[model samples]
Target: MSTTTTLEAPNTGTWDGGNEPMKASYGKLMMWFFLLSDAFTFGAFLIVYGLARHKHMPYTGKADDFTFSTEWWPIPEKVYNAFPGLHGMDLPLAFVALMTMILILSSVTMVLAVEAGNRMDKNDVQKWLLWTILFGATFLGCQAWEWTHFITGTEEGMLLADGTRIFGANLTMNQYGPPLFADLFFFITGFHGTHVLSGVVLLIMIFINTVNGVYHKRGHYEMVEKVGLYWHFVDLVWVFVFTFFYLI
Candidate 1:
């Protein structure tokens, strides 16, 4: 007697002919293509951010207050308030650090989940996927906190150096460092957050399947790998955010 085995190209309806030498499943190949396009989107965004920084920002503080070669935009600390009730704390970057660690950790957990799936260890897969989901959610919570703190300063009214105030207003060009800065911040981060939010939902779906023995019945877990690719992409985007938004 002879037996035959077949491999399914995951997350796609296409039947594999088993002769295409590229060999990866449809899900993974699509992830690679999506990442390529995503890279271009981020490049465009960073390019614009660079352009914004080149134009000298209006400075309220005396020249001595300037840092980073005396030509940088307002110190991120002065512009973005991260710690609540820590007036003049000079610690705006700390929250971003937390956000970064959470995302990176989530990526690590995702890899673990993929490994567990490869080993056909259903219990381990479930465990690692839960951890991945938790870390991703924590990052989202931190981002939500960061956004809230930045939008609402301690004074209740947005106050200028000379005591002028704007209240209940999204920081505009005249209000915040630059209108474009605020706009780009919202667009990029919001887009990224929405991705995280979707990843969480998909993870939940996969978790439920694992619990219900979907992979067990199918005899494999390529679905987990498909989702892991998306999880990693979200983490990669935050690397850009940390570099461009916080570092330089």
Candidate 2:
């Protein structure tokens, strides 16, 4: 009867609100909400991409506009080259792969910075944050290289007027994929890169704050912790991107 009553009666609410929080300040709360919204935005984009990839296969723009119509999208392995280093190399997803590693590493460094902040260790914080910044810069450089490779033709063929696809020197109608596939690749990766760039700028701001002793003067460096959360969230987004765009 007590169990039945507990189940049937109006449920009591949490005293602190609908759910317990992570004992964060208002800034951290806002960051969590912001990350949640950003997550939904990226999720919707990937879902749409998946739907398209399943529905319409792309064409191979080769021999001055080789075209193919199909029931699915271009396999990503066919696209995304790096540069002169990987001439005629299959996949050439190495740059993006390296990019993923750097991003994950930067997230680790950011966490360390937060730890240092908690301990009020300014030198430790600066050192780790510098490493984080360097990793971020490296990721950006790799991204730029990828974009450059896409823009210029390698030993393989070049893109169509659509500016979204590429072809090997001998891409057949049945072999090469669609122009739209290229389009989506550039669009999706570019958007994610922009986010990374934004994160870098924010990181710089926090770095400046630390250097200026803003947090130290205030007696706590929770700002570093909050920013670290954002950095980690960006890295998490890349994991899903790599799985869907590369490994899968």
Candidate 3:
């Protein structure tokens, strides 16, 4: 008598095995997921800004009349024309453009650091990481300076016909056309600056670990690659922020 045996099929529902979903490590995959969610948040913020700008933009026949009108939005070029050390010169978007370049350079250094890690070159990794940190710090410093300048109003601020002198920007008031403009500027740029600061801190910790030969002992520089991914993401987000806030 011949008997047939039944076979059991493999379970593909739950991922219980040691396989990575996309060949990415657990930490890197999680980082990617977090970045994806964060991208949605930024997108929402930018969309709201666009809608607000269109709704509140000046449509009056006289452009000069709507300079300080609450119903109109301030012209970005006029507001951000001041530059460091060249106070009287009208250099619109110069400082912000420099900040963007600094961030891009930092991303390049991050790439070099990741490459060094792949080659197991600890010294080169440290050098590149240090450069990246310096660039990040410089960018943060520039932001702080810009914020201070914005808070300190110009000599002749937006003076209204009602004799209400709007000096500087705050949560409730702004020397600019509308309070919403300042509000969005503070919220969006402040959020991005916070991310840059956090990335710097993370890079510092990773730098310490690299110095201590942690990854070297592990025989892989996956940590550096992971942090590089984060750094690149931050840089990419800044590009969008710059285009939305400054360029557009």
Q: Give the TM-scores of the predictions, in the order they appear.
A: 0.80, 0.77, 0.89
Q: What is the lDDT of residue 175 in candidate 2?
A: 24
Estimate every model's Cα lDDT from 0 to 1: 0.76, 0.74, 0.88
Whole-model alpha-carbon lDDT for candidate 1? 0.76
**Residue runs of model 3 more than 4 Å from their true location after superposition:** 1-21, 59-68
Q: For candidate 1, write residues 1-248 as lDDT tens digits.
A: 55877775555335555355578977788888987898788778878878887776646567455432223355565556456456666665776777788899999999999999999999999999999989988888887877775556445444556776754225464234555666777777887898899999999999999999999899999999989988898888889877887776
Q: Could you tell me the lDDT of residue 85 within candidate 1?
A: 54
Ranking by lDDT: 3, 1, 2
lDDT of 3 by residue, 146-243 (tens): 99888876777888878878787888888876888988989889988999999999999999999999999999999899889889998998999998
Candidate with top lDDT is 3
What 10-residue stretch in candidate 2 is worst by lDDT?
167-176
TM-score for candidate 1, residues paired by index: 0.80
- What C-alpha lDDT, on a 0 to 100 scale, does residue 216 get in candidate 2? 92
Off by over 4 Å in 1: 1-18, 56-72, 84-88, 156-163, 167-175
TM-score order of candidates, top first: 3, 1, 2
- How many residue pairs clash (N, CA or C atoms closer than 3 angstroms) in each of the candidate models, in the order given? 0, 8, 0
Runs of candidate 2 with Cα error greater than 4 angstroms are: 1-22, 58-72, 81-84, 158-176
Clashing pairs in 3: none
